[model samples]
Target: MCTSSVCNHTPKPFALHKSSSVEEYLEKNKQWSQSITNETPNLFSDYNSKGQQPHTLFIGCGDSRYNESIFNVKPGEIFGLQTVGNNLNLNDETIISTLEFTVLVLGIEKIAIVGHTDCGAVNACFDDSVYETLPKNLKNYLKPVYENIKKIKDVHKDDIPPIDKKQLSLENVKEQAKKLLSVDFIKEKFENNTLQILPMIYNVENGLVETIDL
Candidate 1:
């Protein structure tokens, strides 16, 4: 009988090796490319000739579990920008430039900030020991998110119960959504009903995506 709190199903033995070497991954990629080419010969050529006009800008966590397969988006359907914890720093040029290009140039009407449960980045914010071991650049990059989480914890300590990774993940998604709306262009577009920003949480356990009401 399975006794795990989260999962009730018994674990299965691995059919193939759990970890793959670089060459193994490359070989698998070759197989995938060939399979796709054989199944849809004109896919890439059609995308190339038509040019990309993705309707949504999806900002999500760098976690491999929060992938296109979960969102059900096909190739060239979404302009994706992934980062640690799905965080968006206003001063990040890459994020800013990507947003500008997607909205202003590509004319994407929707922006979704997606966070996932049990995020390492969100968990690290609660642990002082993790900060000490992280590289300086990464620590610096994630500082804002850590601070924001801390503020939320401090301010709502009375009303809110004990903070967990799931709650933090949802809050982070909402915070990132607010941050995006803070941009003048985004604010204007949102106010005029030309754009929509959604805060979403992806549950790795159940493979579910739920909207977080802000």
Candidate 2:
């Protein structure tokens, strides 16, 4: 029987509101936090006192299944930058500012642009026959994905018959990796060997992560 307000059929409030589950969740988190502190007291204390030293910057999609925590990397290792689309804006001041800060201030050692299979953004850009109207801001935001599709379309115009959505999705990830290199901070890191930028694609159906070499 579903009891939450969001549930279809319910007569009582959710267990979270009726019971002390919220408190229990907080208590469990506190216990876990203490366990981490006990194991790595110095690093945790230093992290608290000196702020984050996350060396990897992960840029991925807004997909809920693309959980960054599931990367199997150690905690405090990644500085995540998620968006609706994985593409970075060359002209966006905020994105540029964050990039500068991540390199100059955070001293991030790696930059990874990750794209997952069956991404709605990539699908939208690939399928021109669909006429799902979008908001103005969303249209503007998806321009980069559209642009990448156009570039692929142009290059393979005579050879290929309108890129396949699935293949274009993979190519989009590779294209985004090259686009990432155009950033000044990323370029500097590439030149000095201080950072390694990689593009990766995750197969949602199979739960597999495949690295794309750019």
Candidate 3:
């Protein structure tokens, strides 16, 4: 089990000067620790203290608006992995390691691949030309997203219709879910109904999440 100090839920904002960004974060963290402990002093205190056993695994975008706090869950209630586009690349060691630990070790049964409206990564993917100006690392990092969009268009061949970013974002959510289910252990568990995976989309304008039926 993890302590409230180990994971924060509600946050208090602090002033940040150009040179004091780090200092402000640390100060706010201190304040948060003091406040939450006062409110729920015994929160998560009676657990067995055996490492985290979060109920769900969330694959969310790295955007600040889409965070663990959005679900209104306790600090360790949701184990999360946030990426620029909430993508899943089987070749990535970090992704693979997290999957192995969560599914095989911690035994987390539920997973959600969440996307959101007004996503910069999905927008960049929709407009491939933007990639030309990006730095090498960022451009390479988003390559797969572009490739997926390309494949979607290529299927049309003759005249590719304009694709809506929101629709595309939804497609990306579905694609990531499919990618997660592609993993051997995850797929086997899913097939046997031991594991559950769902696709979700977060509406930035409304600050709500909708489940993708696919």
Candidate 4:
């Protein structure tokens, strides 16, 4: 049996339109990718041949808009662990497994914990009094931050309200770095000075990455 399927195609000329920067970014990447494949085949050839070195483990928020490449850091130089809400899940098996692999297997010399401003999770935790409801897992996931925030006895009530969100965000990042240090493999490397962990906050306002002094 012989059968033939034919297709009809229509083409349209490119027309510029006013759009969000995100849309413009997508369009630009589309053009750049096509141009790269056509003109610069070696651009990604090493990536295919070598694979990921990723000596630094980066744990950050799962925000779609916070792309690592925007930091100008090259690929295959950092091992990344992105989780929703940037909550360090010590109890989570997957999180622990990744930590172990990054430290022991990958022998990552440095781990950086990154938190950002205007985090939806931090905002929600700050205002949980209103919602009064959240899933058990989610509640559990955010327990460390909530508990840490509650323990900030030195922060006055007046100073507490506004800075609560921001302070907790920074504290959470610091605590996460500490929590990562608690891992057996991590602790050994850290104590031996073989691995170093640092925390940072990415300012949404200036797009600046500032080291968080723990």
Candidate 5:
């Protein structure tokens, strides 16, 4: 029905459509894949023929904002393992297997444990309210990181002074790097200068990565 000037157009019946989020993602991915294929016809073929010879094992947080693009690395350049808080459990079979394969088989020479400023996981570790509200599995997963932070805080009880969440994020990166280096295989590689373990911090604000001494 039309009445006023604004209502001159006929009204269309409302119809339920597919989920916009899923549809949009699929559409965008389709277009992106097509564009890549058109721009570099042999990209995928080259990857298949050469296989993956990644030089770095980049362990970063699961946060979507942090990605391989941040390092300006092309596909197949880095084998990435993303976990919450960029945490790693050396005893976990999945992690151990991946590490072994990447180091021994793939011959990756560098392991970078990267954390970022204003990390939600780091904040949640110190915030009891948030920690209390997380799911049981997530809480268990993050428990080691929480305990590690607590230990760091305790060490700073004297004249060292307490640190904020950003500093804690850096400390978490260092702790995770230490854990990775403690593995016998990884330690052997390190002692022999076959492997390098780096603790890195990415500043989300400035898009700059700084290496931290472990």
Candidate 6:
């Protein structure tokens, strides 16, 4: 059956569907803008006129599950920076510069270091096989999470599973919050009672945050 009669085959269409579709996002944004503007006529105009004067620099996980709405944050409220495992480093220029701009320039008074439950990046710390499999840049980016987990384990190796993850996450927030104080500007501001750091963990299973008692 060697047929050359055009094969009579319908080729699959080439299109960007699912999360990869920028067109989908643009359309949704257009609809949302219309709906929101209809509800709060002056919202966008106020945002444009006032610019952003966010109160908190919310350092959070890069997990798509969490966002402003999840935290009950209105637009232009929290200056958020999302990182893998919510890892913070002074060396990461993006983190440092955001801190400098928010704290020094914008006079943001609060800092929220937040970690979440069942984080893929945090889980990878225990998977011995994951280290070599990740792309070089991704592996390097995850170094801080790993190092922090290691430090936690070294002190509390007997802890297991949910307990381990919970402590690790809470401690992660605590440690990241502490690291900000190491920054000269942050230390000065904190010492002067101008900046407050709140360490928290969002339980994905419960959708509730547990604040670290520090």
**Candidate 3 lDDT over residue span 60-130, tens digit each:** 99997777677887666788999877878789999999999898988888998899999887777566577
Candidates' C-alpha lDDT: 0.80, 0.73, 0.78, 0.72, 0.80, 0.78
lDDT of 5 at 9: 69
TM-score of each predicted structure versus truth: 0.80, 0.72, 0.80, 0.71, 0.79, 0.80
Off by over 4 Å in 1: 1-23, 34-41, 127-139
Model 6 TM-score relative to the real fold: 0.80
**lDDT tens readout by residue for model 6, 1-214:** 5386445474534333455678777887898788778977887898836898888888899997785456776677888899887888788899999999999998999998888988886666655477446566754656656767657645655655534666767777777888888999999999999999888899898799888965
Which regions of candidate 2 are displaced past 4 Å? 1-49, 131-162
Candidate 3 lDDT score relative to the true structure: 0.78
Q: lDDT per residue, candidate 4, 122-208, as tens digits?
A: 766666563346555745556554545444423434662565667767877887888887788888888999998888887776788
Per-residue lDDT tens digits for candidate 1, residues 1-214, read 5467646464655333568688887887788767767877876678745899888999999997776557776577888999877878778899999999998899999998889998887777656577556667755656766666666545545655677768878878888898998999999999999999988899988999999999
Lowest-sum lDDT 10-residue window in model 3 = 42-51
| Backbone clashes under 3 angstroms, per model | 0, 0, 0, 0, 0, 0
What is the lDDT for 108 in model 5?
96
Location of the lowest summed lDDT over 10 successive residues in candidate 5? 10-19
- List pairs with backbone clashes in candidate 3: none
Which pairs clash in model 4?
none
lDDT of 5 at 212: 97
- Report how far off residue 158 is in candidate 3 (Å): 8.5
Better of 2 and 5 by TM-score: 5
Candidate 1 RMSD to the correct structure: 4.1
RMSD of each candidate?
A: 4.1, 5.7, 8.3, 11.4, 8.0, 8.2
